[model samples]
Target: MFDIQEELKKLPDKPGVYIMKDANGIVIYVGKAVVLKNRVRQYFHQSANHPPKVQAMVAKISEFEYIITDSEVEALMLECNLIKKYKPKYNILLKDDKHYPYIKVTMNEEYPRILKTRRVEKDGAKYFGPYSSGFAVNDAIDTLKKLFPIKTCNRKLPNDIGKFRPCLNYHLKKCLGPCQGEVNKNEYHEMMRKICSFLSGQYDEILNDLKAQMEEAAEQLEFEKAAQIRNKISSMTQLSEKQKVLSTDGQDRDVIGFSRDATDLCIQVFFVRNGRVIGREHYIFEGEGDEEIGYSLSTFIKQFYNNVQFIPSEIVIQNEIEDSETISQWLTEKRGHKVSIRVPVRGELVRLVKMVSQNAEVSLKLFKDRLKRVDNVNEEGINQLMKLLELEQRPRRIEAYDISNTGSSEIVASMVVFIDGKPARQEYRKFKMKSVEQQNDYASMQETLYRRLSRAKKEKEENIEKPKFSDLPDLILVDGGFGHVSAAQQIADEFEYRLVIAGMAKDSRHRTKSLVYNGKEYELSAYMPLLRLITEIQDETHRVAVDYNRTLRAKRYTHSELDEIEGVGETRKKALLKHFKSLAAIKKADIAQLMEVQGINEKVAIKIYNYFRNK
Candidate 1:
């Protein structure tokens, strides 16, 4: 019923978010357009000119929707929110969104606690990250804990300050024992302030502050305090001396570089804070093979900054994206300062970009090599598994099932497909557990398997050409023991389908222990390739299931937070979240920014502003 040409006629030439839905009314892709009319019409008008992915997406577009925004930046943010919410199939999905952790300092608390977290909440706390990975974040936190006596405990301070005795951390000199009221509040706060300065690359300022405090303490005859400050100054000065200064200008910049193979692209971002390379991160993603570097890099910039808080004054890339000026303007607004986007073709900046690109190339090559090794191991595992289980044929196609949830609220299941020992990611699917929603894993697994196999059977019977469900897996693995295998068997019996079902059993330490099948347990061998392959599959399925469940839980949590506010519906909530990027951002937003969002007016904006303020 949706006419493409008719909708094209009504399209306005403004910035907006666009949604493309398939025949089943499921959103397959989401994008932002600077000129809605020109952008939307281009797809329908010149379908042949688009890349294959776009062409295929267009071919399946049963309907499309758009929401106008005040600026292209707003559209860009809205597009990210929509893509995250729907997880449109064709969009470039960042699977590791929550994988990178941040070092969060609870500055608002009376006694601040520095911890590692992936979630960023707006509780007046300071967060530094999207670190290389969780390990890196943990390492940073550990180092900070060693360098500074900031509290790592979760005890309620001031109220419970003198209630408990000091713990082992105090004995080890790792903590100042704020819980036992051994440290002055002002002095502890000063330590936290110094830690902030250290994180922000104010090394000289910290040293100067420590030196001044040390001299003051010495003059006052407080030798203990003076000695402590002297030690800190020495440590900080040594750390600064160790840092390799890349530029004398003392400016913050991010060097962006990338390399691509036939199927995947690797991007390396070098974080230069105050001209010193503090850290670097590499990202790997599927590529369209023939994509122009400009488009790919541009899309990356938009999505990368969506979650990052630190926007550098300069972003140097090797190639120019189409909307450099607009992106610069957006970054400037985000950072509340002027931001420059430059494509350095020569000189020092160019060399820096090229260095990052070389790093990216090395990273991509290593990743691909590791992937090749994994594939080989998986192939060998399949062969060994066939021999061990006495199976008739190798499981060239294997399916894995895992159920994950936090208690009973967001029970979900993931089904991942492995073809020839490698992930056939496109064929993987996720299911929300509906039949048994409580903490019953057995019932959840049974329901998920029944639904999946039943649907596969129906599709096989119904479709003759390219029958998607007909190409069933040779083996099915469940993330449980005998109970799950039995459940799968019951479904197989009911459906009159022959299935080779195996359960992955974990040891007391929660490590993959063995394969349980047919009332027999095959103990995992450390040297066996089969064990590693099964562990990999199990880990992957668990990750997928947990991620999906987390997404659902987040959506529910976000809905509950906004749904209670008067005059805010689904559309308005989306608009606010998209425009502000996060609930914390929305909470911090003034009435003007709130009003600038698509569906919000002055009255609603004031209401929202007051709501967060009062809360």
Candidate 2:
């Protein structure tokens, strides 16, 4: 038996992280402190004043654990990671887990290519703009291509020179045709430098160069060349005009502002680069109205920067955070330069901050209004569903299951979840049939339910932390008629898991027709809200199942006998296929012929030859 009092006494008088857990061993809250002994002991003190959120969390605390760190900075880092991993209930979280798009200049290559990517890696390439809009990134890349005759092909540059004819891009005058060695290396690299400068919001230099080229072309009486140059200059001018200039310092910074209502909090961030406001994004945190603005803003900064591809040199916010200095140190280390977190009291920065905050307020109100409309529709749907099925209470969490297969092969099932009439995509689960060998939908449904219920039972009994299966749904809906409902109910009964089980019956056209419950068909045509809700659930479940089945079939089709051989991975496999044209041709090839394929060494060639000969 674990005692909270004993664990509290054992906390060391050092900087570290503390995790509070409930009786079920689930982490309810995670925090960091300068002194573990002092911080951890404060929660258990009867006379200590605490906020409502902290008080509620403390009441649920059954046990606590601590990890000592060398300094408060290390503790903060560890706390950020833990909060991200566990998403503790008490910690204010940034719920927008978006991986923004970036424009990558592949400077690592001999002939660099400009591309849009979602990931930023340390590959000696320059990246620009973790842009909020993919369409904007695409437009920018398209415009850059028009402005520069850079190559778009993936040829191995100097090595692949003269190996193939110039592609259509070169014929269309969109590329410099480096594959054919038409452009000098130094000249092509000079153009790439101009492209990089343009991406960095340095438009004046490129515009002047374009104007000079146009003037020279016209002086030489080359009307077509001068026309193209004029067009390029026009494009660049329009692109530069789109960026709203905010400062003359040419510094990259982010302006963060927030607004809170009775129940919702919205944090808006403006991305400013090179004195221009490139883009803005807003994050919504529900049920944070009671949280202090400074504390919430601090937590938002830590969580937001943790996953971002780039960190700006300065972060301007409306309020002073308690850990501003510590967060600045962390961000500076991340950015590999000096970073400052500022709360402006006077100047244009203060005005900018206020503008961002006002935008946040407007965004919050609009979001809440939209949410209210959605909530009303969802409530009507739930109420109608309750009346139709005679459910005692609202079914807040509904799980639906469907099975898919190709004849008697590759049987799969999908479990999709809907919470409060909204799809909870993260909670979805997929399973490959283990016991059932044939294309039997009823048997497959039973196996899926049995496995799911068994896991739920095990999770509850073992007190699993961050349990996925233990959270039983308030209702279960299977995609079929009476037979599927009976199969699911049988398993639910075996596990003694009491919940309403129904079947979504579909017509011949694969449209939802009715709901089967208690061996009776409940037509949903009269209840439009319930019908739409059930149809959405049924379609989503079927789509997930079919997608899983298609993925499995694709894998099976892509597999080859070459996969079984050692030292022949995807690259070598493709090489062999391209060289021999077919598996039959590969089998006929001798060791000498096998060695003709690139990446096929003598040892691997012998292994392939021997294996085929033995077969």
Candidate 3:
């Protein structure tokens, strides 16, 4: 129904983003174009030369969609968001999609606190570092705490002062005890200023000040105070030495470098703050050998910077990338200052880029070696599994199902997937049993399978795009004996879906015992690889099912009748609970008594009274 030529003709002349989807409606590629009509037409033109990757993507394009934007910048923004959301197959994706931790100084409070967080918000707080890991952030915080006696508790200072006894931290000299009103406001603010300076990589000034104080304390014959200052000086020295200085300009920047082989690419990024290299991280991309270095590097920049909490003032790379100017503009907007994307031609920066690229090459080699070992183990498991089940082909994708419940409530089923002997976590799905009211595992299994397969059948018949259930697995596994397997097979038969369907049987101790298929139990104890694979699948399916059941039970336990009232929100609910002491008392209270609660007006009181009276 989707004519490529006709759709190409309909593309507008304005800038926009285009999405290419396959027959099953899975987005294969996403691109931005300054002029939609001209750019989109080039893909379908037979005379146009295209890379092998693009050719493969085009061969699978069954339909396409486009969104017009006001400017090319807007299109680029949308393209980044869409690529992050869908992670299209043909796009270069950063495998390590992690938001590194940051150290936050809550300057917005009357008495500030230093804490570790992953989010950077505009709340009048100063943030430092997208540190390599939580450990790194904790290390920095721990060092600061050792040097400064700042408060760590969440008590509202100045108001909560003198209301409660100082905590153990104050007695141990770990905190300044502002809650006890023992600390001067001016002195505390000055200490916070020094802490901020230390985090900004200004070590020499703080070190000199600490040394001077140590000598002054010794001169005054305060030996213990002088010893403490000496220890603080030592700690500061150690921390500063950990951050190796790379430049004298004291500017923040990121150095990105990559190394590629025939099939794999590794990108390494060095985070430099105040001209010091704080940390480095590496990302691996598979099957990108044919992609241009510029294109891959450009895509990596957009995806990486999009999710991070902080954007550096400069980005240094080994080569010039596609749309460098536009990417710089986007980064500049995000950073609230001018950002530069530079390709170093000579000097120290060029040397730094080469060093990062060397690290990336070493990482790629180690990764490939480890991957080869894992692949061998997985391939053997698959081969053994196919032989055990008499399957015609290797079960590249195996879907395992399990049913879980507590009594007759919150009956749920889970489907876990394993592709090529590794768990495919994104494909795992859970279902809450809708039709089965009682605790019947057979009926629950049947309903789960029926709903799952029905969706697949509907998508296949209608050629639906953005399908919920895409392709059926090559093998079906149920975490039970013969009955569960029989129920699942009945649903599969109704849809004429043919594949190996089996159950994972357990021994007396509930450990994986054998595979039950075609009314026969296949012993797996003699084959360790196959047994381990089956056990993993069975355990994962059970964990998913049980976790869902527990979540539903927790929700039901937390449910309050007051939540059903139209005008009662969390604040009013808390107020009612606090005033009445119990739900039973609230039910018995008159409308006037209910109105006495804060934020609860006469209308809400009447509604609550009527609801309880009717019930």
Candidate 4:
């Protein structure tokens, strides 16, 4: 095993890449850093000032590797490229891998159609940005359609001289009347040229032309045409001026960036396609971290581009990164064309970089705020459980099981997953105590826990590469005070997995009074809330097992008043259960609401309404 602190000490302050390898030397995380000394060292520090989530990541890191770069910008560039190549597990990544939209112009035909494209390819087509906001891009498309109305359909016009109607757009003064043979080669070509210039942001000429057209139409007594032209000009001017934000004068390039606070993170990205702010979107991240602004941008860029098919030609960034060459290399290789990255010092581009940095700061702050309570678990209690059970690691999600039986008949087991301080009911499981041969109390507990833990261990071994809730527990909370705890301990010890085994003991009044663990009894009732929580969890688990046993005895059938209605079977029964979760919820569900479930169709809904109405 490699010494982690020694590896941390070897990290240089220069810009570079770092890889976090597990005990097996599997690369779990790969990151680029402008200041290796600061970033790498932060992970090793034992400061209670850190967020619990960050602390958790630090605890899991066993070994690491690094490569120093000359400049921070180089580090940024390299980090993004590496992230794309090796998708790290612990990184603030873009979820739902989608590239921003691009304005694509294809050279596949003499007459090219301008369209919004998600994927960029090598079929002789020029592509613009990967837009973050689909709504904004759609708005741009709507505006373009109103202004120019290029062929919206994917069908190519037959080159056989005269085929197909120009459609409704030709008569509406939308399309250049291309269908009526009214537009000559020169006239139609001129419209495309004007569109090219307008989209490219040389809008001074567009305003001038619209003004001239409005004036000419008004003088010729064409008031409607003049009004139409005037409205188009006004819309164009307002659209250009709306996003008159921080650095609008530069050559069009999408500014993609992300930020995090405590609770959640948001990645704010904008598409500056053809020098216009055409699209923008923000992706919400649920984790917390303390990585610098540049490193975040690099990580996001790599992760974003890894799954997305397109890359812009010029990516201007907040941090001039060290990994610039590598990222550019990877992107160029992907796009089959060269891409460049720059960190400007003085011009509008530099201001744009600063603006992006500011956005990241805002985003990170939001992330931090949300996570302040999410993963703030009771480490002492968890560690105590871990030590008592003799487990390998602290359990993030623990499940405790107990068997309940009415003599030898209604034997069932209840399983619950404790997430942080609360019960994660979604992960709660139940099983019937089958194959136990006899209905002995100790044997029943052993049977139930053995089945649960054995299955969990098998899952952990099978999915050793991936950590999941199926792994063995940190602690097992048996329902009985002492007898159940003793029974559970033996099974865990038999499997050679250290686990904390405890039981919630209740007084004669069914009130939780003490916890029995490893042959000792400790009163827990003094902590009213903790005691109450434990009792509720224990009761819920017991109830769950009893209910499962009842259902198993019932055997593949559930009788409900809802099922008495026509057209209601297992599907509708389950639907009613899911919608309502209980009989009370079903009673509250009105006819109108009941009709909302799909299979209710029409006749069934009416029957359900009357049945409930009469009942």
lDDT of every model, 2 decimals = 0.81, 0.88, 0.88, 0.67
Candidates 1 and 2 compared by lDDT, better number: 2
For candidate 2, write residues 510-595 as lDDT tens digits.
Answer: 66768999989986655656766787788889999999999999989999998888889989999999988899999999999999
Provide TM-scores for the models: 0.52, 0.60, 0.61, 0.49
- TM-score between candidate 1 and the true structure: 0.52
Question: By TM-score, is 3 or 4 better?
Answer: 3
Q: What tens-digit string does per-residue lDDT give for candidate 1 at 1-615?
A: 888888889999999988999999999989888999988888887635765457667889999999999998888778878877898887777665534566788899888888888777777998764466677666656667767877887789889988888889888888999999879998998889888777766677767767898999999999998997787676666655544566767688888999974346788898876677767888887543335678778877877877676778899997889988888988898788999999987778887888899999999889767866654767787888888788998898999999998897898999999998888998889999787858988888889888887778888778767655667789999999999999888988898888899999886546676789889988654225676578678988999999999899888876657777899998999888888888889888899988889989999998898888888
Q: Single out the weakest 10-residue window by summed lDDT for candidate 2.
A: 523-532
Q: The CA-based lDDT of model 1 is what?
A: 0.81
Instruction: Report the lDDT of model 3 for residue 273.
Output: 89
Q: For candidate 3, what is the TM-score?
A: 0.61
How accurate locally is residue 243 in candidate 4, as Cα lDDT from 0 to 100?
50
Model 1 stretches astray by more than 4 angstroms = 1-3, 46-48, 105-113, 119-126, 148-151, 154-162, 171-173, 177-190, 202-245, 331-339, 345-347, 374-615
Candidate 3 lDDT over 1-615, as tens digits, reads 998988888899999999999999999899999899998888889997776567777889999999999988888899999998998988888767788888899888878999999999999999888788899888989999999889999999899999998899999999999999989988888889888888889887889999999999999999999999999999989998888888888899999999975455799999998888888899988766446799999999988998898999999998898799989998888889999999999888988899889989998889766764676766776899888778888788899999999999999999999988999999999999999999998999999999999888889889998887868899999989998889889888888888679999886557676889999988664465676578778988999999999999998998998989999987999999999999999999999999999999999999999999999
